[model samples]
Target: MAATAVPTPPLLQISSTQPEPGSLVVEVDGEVDAASAPELSVALEPVWAAVSTRVVLDLSRVTFLGTAGLAELLRAADRADAAGVALRLVGGTRCVDRAIEVAGLAGRLPLSPDLGHAMHR
Candidate 1:
């Protein structure tokens, strides 16, 4: 008899929302670092291609982040800008918030205190 193979679950979970037209809300929960940024990028590619101008990335549930993750965020922002879309991040933990500030992306990337505020901005 052959042994059964086990399936591996995705490390990141991306949920999409439609608060209004031409807008997309993506909630990501999981570690986003060098090894995982590519996965995150792949998950977001479809959303970016959908013509959603306003993109909100809720990172409240993200427990870990690294330079690669930050770079990925910047890339996403650049893509959004080129597409005439607005990208924002919301609800980060102290560590995650500090990481963004340390990377000198706080001013360049729109970040709000919470998801609600991010959506409004």
Candidate 2:
């Protein structure tokens, strides 16, 4: 008997842009889980490295965010704090909001209502 292969879900999509001189915005779509968190990390490491800049994560389009995803956000927040860079999350899907709330990070993570609000601050 041949063993059946487990089907993998769609990978997360990440796009990065420099909205201004000292700001970076990363947009995410699809599901982010243990398998896809590495991609998230790769996209975020540079933002973390660039000290004294603001980084905003746009997650309104995200369908799902798992524990790994939340972990990465926490790490980014820590790095942003240490580097003196502002970090913000714009747009919150139900999954993203629930995950953050469950992780007890509703206040810790800088969350903005929309891109316009995030950009202004």
Candidate 2 residues 1-121, lDDT tens each?
9999999766799998887888888999888889888899998887777636788899988888899988888888898888898888975678888888878888998578898798788
Error (Å) of candidate 2 at residue 27 is 0.6
Writing each residue's lDDT as its tens digit, candidate 1 over 36-65 gives 899889978887778656899998888887
Against the correct fold, how does model 1 do in TM-score? 0.86
- Give the C-alpha miss distance for residue 49 in model 1, angstroms: 2.7
For model 2, the local distance difference test gives 0.84
TM-score of every candidate: 0.86, 0.86
Show the lowest summed lDDT stretch of 10 residues, model 1.
44-53
lDDT of each: 0.83, 0.84
Which pairs clash in the backbone of model 2? none
Look at candidate 1 and give me any clashing residue pairs. none
- On the 0 to 100 scale, the lDDT of residue 35 in model 1 is 83
